[model samples]
Target chain A: MKRFGKLEYYFAALITITFSNTILGEGFDSTAFITIFVALTVMYKGLVVIDHFMELKEANRYLRMMMRTYFFFFPSLIILSTMF
Target chain B: MSSIESSNTLAIFPRSWSQQNAGRVPGNIPIWVGILSELTEFGIFFTAYFIAKFNYPEVFASGPLSLNTTIGVSNTVILLASSFFMAKAMSNVRRDDYKKCERYLWYTFICACMYLSFKSYEFYWNDLQGFSTKTNEFFTVYYYMTFNHFLHVGWAACAILWVIFRLRSGAYSAKEHSGLEALAVYWHMIDLMWILIFPLLYVLR
Candidate 1:
């Protein structure tokens, strides 16, 4: 479990860096695609922290749901703000 | 040890809570409550930010352009790495490896320090470029949000130091380290918040 958890962490970190480069790279335009990409990337990073790093997966259903909901809810909000 | 005796030994948390949530959550229930409250607070901040952006669309539109994207990305990576080390610390503690836990905590602290340093420089760079709270509505919220997050990271750093001290004095063990777990959860919360904040202020154009 520990080894697999470490691999998960590394994978999340690698994904974050890869997307960050795309967003921060030169002349990168923030169109609808980039906006959605950023929102999804942020959501993915938050989930990793909540579930794997915080080990909320082993937690009670309510506890896990509550924390997981934040990631989803806020990214939805971000998407809403962008559309408007 | 009797259940009661073990509960007494772990009196940092309410005995009932310790018993009730022993395997239910990652840390103390009270800390989860605090985390919930903190998340709500940030929720309010995000609402305010969006409202301000709605009111001042022009200001919001150009806000990310002036900011240093490099600094924002660096800080994001730093916090992510720091959270990783903190998680490792918790795993070590769970394995009854205090030495490895302490080492990982130090690594977390170093990453935290690097974040603070980069943030300080970012602020300095902002000042040099004549961006301040008074610069515009965007900067006003920018300063408010980042400063609030900074205070949080500052508090978490102090908590990390305290946890290290207690760990050294044998206050935590594999079986009863709710305090350490709580600290790890709190640190991860900080990281989670930054994950939201980074794009809102920097990458989202």
Candidate 2:
């Protein structure tokens, strides 16, 4: 079952991540907190998909590094967009 | 073995016995070139969306309310599931489990269709509410962001279909599955782009 490992958890996490953020967001008008939470989860979810699903965990260092770095960097642009 | 060899111009990792060909992109150079170019184009589109949003924060923040968050979240999950199935298909292909690989591809394709249908419904709902690309700057960016992704999804779905057909013909094996891997990578990239798009467009109020 190595192939099936954590597949369910990823699904559960994806559902939980989006809904919790969407639900918790209703309570706070604080855009910063909401955005920070979303960004963190975006990074979390993106990395998970990259390493686990894409199987890039064992991939070439350049591609792995670039792909993971892209996850972290993309959200920064979103936050910066709001600032500027 | 750790580093890939670069052309004579520049080498990344040290020239080692095991890594003699490490410089090449994974899943062949051609697909990497295509994926990178496609990502760069989307990167520009995303940059444009954010710039427009920056100029009109009020419009941006207020726009998502009229749209359904549930639908957006569902679409995101759907795409993620599709990516997972594609990944599984790739793994199965790697294991030479040809029949299961084809089944997984079918699952991924079905998931893709579900996502496209749901997205189409969302677009219809927006249109019924008079939300068009011409609505305003916010709607303009929203349309661009979603539709640009929609177009990519179209491209991915087509590629997936071709990959499925190939898998059906038993053209891929454990050692010769680079084509399948390339399609999987492209699909994952589509999923990757949407993870950011979903929150930025729908949830970041």
Candidate 3:
């Protein structure tokens, strides 16, 4: 079971790479939309890993909250700063 | 007979005989705090990357063009494999298998070396092409973000080496291996940071 979970994580990583590359090959105007969408997808996948695989949900609540804030805020801030 | 018996009894509680032994075992802090600190540091670098991208999107686009995706993907796999070895090392330490722990640690070290080697090659290639920190805003952020990650890789390698040495010396028992715990956490942080970096810098437009 644990081995399967690890393999699934790796599969997700490969998908992310493929998705990002596809976005990169598009035109700039199209690239921005794809990039944003890809970013969101990456963020969602990361959060799922943190919450489930990494067992953050079972961890200290304060720590879990801090991680949630750090992950969401940092990436969102980066994307927004870039876009605007 | 009485004096000899008394001295033999004192051997088990030798700690009461000296002040130095009182501090032998240090306090064990949770390893998660160290991991969090590293995550925050990487966050700052990511923020800088974005700020640069906002100010100069063209430069960012050009910078990505120069990056060799082959090397990027290879390094990503190396780090991912290293994470697995690190986890195995931790598991071995928990199981009191010092030999297996050492083997896994050595494997992790090799992966770290591979990562550093590829990064050095990239840096040399970039430098030869004149894509330096002063080239443009994009190059500046690229160098900064990637170089900072390289530094973390170095630190992690050193930590892994320390854990390996301690394991070899039997300093870490199954019941108490905080060093291994801390290093494993640190290794995961390195992997997690690269996950974001590979996409943002190499793959994304």
Candidate 4:
């Protein structure tokens, strides 16, 4: 389990670095890449880390549901508002 | 049948353990609420950023170019390191290593202080350069967001200090360390908010 957790951390770091460099480079589109990265990272933290690993889901069902609602609502609202 | 064995059993089965861990397995509501509140605040900032960008893109562009990217990047790294230490502190508490927990908490607090100092330097230099909050809408948001985050850092530092004092006074056990959990959650939230804010305001503006 610990090794798996370490692997996950490495993967996250790799993603962050790659995306960061890409965003930094000229001729790269910022909006699409940032939106994608933010969505993926937030989902990973909210669903995978907090809910699964942190055991928040088991501890507080209502809070878990509220989190799910929040993750779904806020980003989508922002994206939609930006779009139209 | 020695006195030491009896004392060991009593230590292992303290009354506080049952009382503290009884409410929920691991109470993390304080952290949950704190993060949610921060997310709302960040969302508001993002909305304002979009509004400013739509109205005056050139102004926002000039603002980011003037920022010290090196300091921003260093602060990001520092906050990430603090999160790691905060996690370690929680782990120490779980293992009933109060001394180690206090040490890690102090390290996290130091990182928080360092982050605030860098931020203060940035703000001071900006002000000396005549970039006050009244400079422009862009500078207004810049100061507002960063200053608000600084307040959070100070609050987290104080909480960490309180946790250290509690640990020293034997006020927290492995089972009853809600304070540590709360501090860790707040520390992580602070780091997470910066991860977004640094790139948005400093790098990608």
Candidate 5:
């Protein structure tokens, strides 16, 4: 069971989001690669919020899994479609 | 300023509040409804965006390039900082540091203001650059999606102000701060939505 302090998770998310811009700026040839990277970064940020900021670290498994699934599944499809 | 010691004079939360509400939904049920509705509304817009993007790849690809990535990144940082302070306010409330909580919320409000400042500048700049809802499919989606979110931020700003007033009025405590927690969750949802929107609209170009 992994848990993070709220401030730590926020910093982690800020860095991830800010960092994605660099990859995106590298020109369009690698847009496909950065799309995948940005998708996964978004997922990680969502999971951190669900787990830490929302304090779902100890919530019911059903609710936890539900939010997790939505965050994981939907953005994923968008990225997949963008790439393919 | 009401001191925490003086706060003890008021009725504290019943000791079993946590144990009683254990295993329930994350926060107050009504907030979950608000959050879900917001998510559903954004979902529809995002679907339309992607559908339009797929059909008009050239426009979607060129769209973000015209927009200023610097403003987008800075706005994201400001919003994340606002969310950070909001979370800190919640943790302070959990610790019975009502004064500290109120201070953190004010900080969050300041960050919200800063976010709006950058956002306003971006919109003004876009207008000067001749981008509008009628410019093209991409701007249509961009203006609609971003403006709708801007509306939510307006509501969130008002809510934070109200909560700050209530915090000063001695309306909450360590063990009985569900309303504060719910507000924090809503703000976090805004941050989460932007996490998706920032990368989708600006970065993934």
Candidate 6:
């Protein structure tokens, strides 16, 4: 039997995380916890795409850091706006 | 970073400094420039989204309730799947599996078509609900942001087709497939942008 490739596994994980984030966010009141949770999920998904799909893991340190920063910055902004 | 190898300092880093020398930017440097510009464009749009959102918290809070979550979520899934297929195609190409790479590209093209179809249906659904760019601040942001993204996806779809044709012509191989890698990266960026947008527009109530 042919098992799933590493990229396939990453894709599955991303899909799972996406749906779980949506369901949990929508199933309950949009509390701070839920909002932060969603933000974190977005960050995780972005990082996966950057590192794996974009093939940035072995990329130049500066370029890799720049991509990572974009993912972190936006999610943090989302959290910040929700707070105040 | 220089690609030169210095054997003497390889041990100090411990994580295989030799491999560290292998680190280089993925795809073409020019494509990275384009990616940066795309990111800036979407970054500005996101800024506007947050500004309007904070200004009218009630409107932002209730905006998503009116949108079609089913279409939005479906499109998100489609884009994610498309990017995955694109990534798979790139991996196959790197392994000199041109046949598999071509197959995966077709899969990605199918996903892109599905996404565009659902998105168009979403616009019609919005029209039925009497939503438009003039609806309100919330709807205005929604329409503009999503429409811009829709256009990007369209361009990316064309690029995928171009890459497919080029591959068929034997333009790519394991030893030199930067063009394919570039398209994959661009496609993933499109998918990543939507990953953020979907939650904001459909789920973050």
The candidate with the higher lDDT, 1 or 5, is 1
B124-188: candidate 6 lDDT, tens digit per residue: 99999999999888999999889999999999999989999999999999988989888888898
Ranking by DockQ: 2, 6, 1, 5, 4, 3
Model 6: per-residue lDDT, tens digit, A1-84?
987888889889998988887787678888888888899999999999989888888776666888899999988988998777
Per-residue lDDT over A45-68 for candidate 5, one digit per residue giving the tens place of the 0 to 100 score: 788777777777686455577678
Encode model 3's per-residue lDDT on B12-70: one tens digit a residue. 44534321322221112346656767787888888888867777877777677787777
Model 4 chain B weakest lDDT span, ten residues long: B16-25
Q: Write the per-residue lDDT of candidate 1 for residues B20-50, one digit (tens) a residue.
A: 4544666776788899899999988888888
> How large an RMSD does model 5 have?
7.0
RMSD of each: 4.0, 3.8, 9.1, 7.8, 7.0, 4.7
DockQ of each: 0.48, 0.53, 0.18, 0.20, 0.40, 0.52
lDDT of 4 by residue, A31-83 (tens): 65565555445445445434433345555444556556655654454344334
Best by lDDT: 6
Model 4 stretches astray by more than 4 angstroms: A1-61, A64-84, B1-35
- How far off is residue B26 in model 4, in Å? 4.7
The better-scoring model by DockQ among 2 and 3 is 2
User: Using Cα atoms with residue i matched to residue i, what is each candidate's TM-score against the true structure?
Assistant: 0.88, 0.88, 0.76, 0.73, 0.86, 0.92
Mind giving the per-residue lDDT tens digits that candidate 4 earns over B72-189?
Answer: 8778767766776776777778899988888888888889989999998988878788888899888888888888989989988888888888889988898788766766766766
Grade the docking of candidate 1.
Answer: acceptable
Clashes of each: 0, 3, 0, 0, 0, 0
**Candidate number with the higher lDDT (1 or 6):** 6
**lDDT of model 3, residue B20:** 33
Q: Number of the top candidate by DockQ? A: 2
Q: So what's the TM-score on candidate 5? A: 0.86
Candidate 1 C-alpha error for residue B115, in Å:
1.0
Cα lDDT for residue B5, candidate 2: 24
- Native-to-model Cα distance after best TM-score fit, residue B147 in candidate 3, in Å: 1.1
TM-score, model 1 to reference? 0.88
Residue pairs in candidate 6 whose N, alpha carbon or C atoms collide under 3 angstroms: none
